[model samples]
Target: MEIDYSTIKVIGFDADDTLWVNETYFREAELEFAKLLSGFETPNKIDQELFKKEIGNLPLYGYGIKAFTLSMVECALELSNYTLPNATIEKILNIGKNMLNKPVELLDGVEEVLEQLSKKYRLILATKGDLLDQERKLEKSGLTTYFHHIEVLSDKQNANYSKLLNHLDINPSEFLMVGNSLKSDVLPLVNIKAKAIHVPFHNTWAHEMVTQKETSGKKYETINTLRDLLKMV
Candidate 1:
């Protein structure tokens, strides 16, 4: 189970929950969204339906707050049998706007870890989300300088990672990815013969979750915080 770090040349980082507070805000927005539609369905039902809608809409919208807001609006209309009011629709839009405007809050030791590691290995950001929103966060993050490359992927799959590694001319054995989602961050890299470290965030979107069966033979390291990465690399 020992992962050799001596061969790693390029380190990829997942942006959202790994470097900053992302899912926590989404959780808060979900609560607010549920409250807005409480008259149509209970909060629990709304949450379940919303998650279903998100999964169903993934191909069309991809990941990001805009897609989530659109899904929320669609769920509201469907739950109310298309009788949802304009006022409620407006409230949902406002919720998305609020999230977009919220300040970027970096997770503990994010900058320090990035700063320290950048001095050695080449750093790249391997994250997936809406391009505009991801660009906005990177701009606000103030940690942009540490990264040598930034990729905003439409999805994180083995093929996607292969393409990225190929584009960067990096060998799988010499690459490592760090992130919070096992499905997006760890499994894909492991499948591609690369190293991955899982830094779990307290809250994760339902869509990004994976069963133990899916990760059964995946080889990766799990760290409690970004600060712990300083010791690894």
Candidate 2:
């Protein structure tokens, strides 16, 4: 389907995988976490339990490395039946720290796409994670000047996007969001009658994965790379 971008006055970008590398580090950390707890459970079981812990903690802790660290620490204690060594707990904490300190690696063509699109439309960084960490990544990214606004949301649901558009004085029909997660970036905007474009990253978190049924009737466009934006919009 050919969609029109004529009414799109503002564009929102998802920070993590959409702009730079994110989920890859989480995958690495999970492996490290599994190895640390291998004595208590098989790697597969450790992975499954850790995912449950992260999802269960979402309501209280929200998203980001800090929350993931806490979940890993808790998982360790439980998996070891409260006999987990203090040293191992420390290792898990270090995992989160190392992830936070990882250098911000921008995706291919990110700067070029952002530079070109910023000229014709208002761009905003619409991402969800620990506020400080997200802010840190943006500062390190050196692409801050390209965005008109930056939002660190608690979650990316329809209501969240609706509130963001209202606060920015932008009509839903006049906004377009581009990102890697269909669950967060695309569906929410489509539900709010806004435009969305999916620019998928190679890796995705299990929690962000959506069923085909959910997206079967959703209206959005998918592009293979960020560079495609310049030609589309």
Candidate 3:
């Protein structure tokens, strides 16, 4: 669907898979760590335990490879009768460290569109992630300057979206939520009467995926790439 960009004041974007690659490293690390502990437990069982820990501890630790590593290592140790030693801890820690150091690869045409759009509208970086990890990724990705406000949210609930819109001096009708997840980015904005453009991404973390209700209640725009958003907004 087409949008009149003239009416859209602030264009919001999700950071991780929306702009640059993330979550892949976490998946990779989990698989490798599971292999390392294969003697103790199956990967499926280990992943189940890790998923449980992630869901139950959502209030404690939001997101990051560090937490994932800790949870996996802790659960593995418990499951395996503490077979993992100090050396194992170091190994896991190094994996997370390597993830941090991995090159920041922005998705195709992210810069071109953001650069094009920034000149016209008030741009905001609206993303939910582990605060430290999120900030570092933004800095490294070289797209921070395009945004007037950068909000690092814990989660994108309706309350979170409402507070953010108010803080930016923008109303729901004037906002356009652009991101990958319908659960976090698109649907939450829809709850508040904000227009949203959903650009789907592969490899959605279990926590971020949501059921797609067939009814079209609010203004919903779906596209394949970040660059294509230019056509609508």
Which number leads on lDDT?
Answer: 2
Residue-level lDDT of model 2, residues 1-233, one tens digit each, is 79999998899999999999999999999999998988889999999999999999999999999999999999999999999988888899999999999999999999999998988899999999999999999999999999999999999999999999999999999999999999999999999999999999999999999999999989999999999988888
- Runs of candidate 2 with Cα error greater than 4 angstroms are none
lDDT of each: 0.94, 0.95, 0.83
lDDT of 3 by residue, 1-233 (tens): 44554577889999888999887877888788788777877889878887887777677777676676667666767777876778877887788789888888898999999999999888899887678888899999999899999999878899999999998789888888899888888888888888888888777889876655532555677899998988876
| TM-score for all models, in order of appearance | 0.98, 0.99, 0.93
C-alpha RMSD values across all candidates: 0.7, 0.6, 1.8
Error of 1 at 146 (Å): 0.6
Best by TM-score: 2
User: What ordering of candidates by lDDT runs from best to worst?
Assistant: 2, 1, 3
Clashing pairs in 1: none
Count the clashes in each prediction: 0, 0, 0
Compare candidates 2 and 3 on TM-score and give the better one: 2
Evaluate residue 154 in candidate 1 and report its C-alpha lDDT on the 0 to 100 scale. 95
Model 3 is weakest, by summed lDDT over 10 consecutive residues, at 210-219
- Model 2, position 209: C-alpha lDDT score: 99
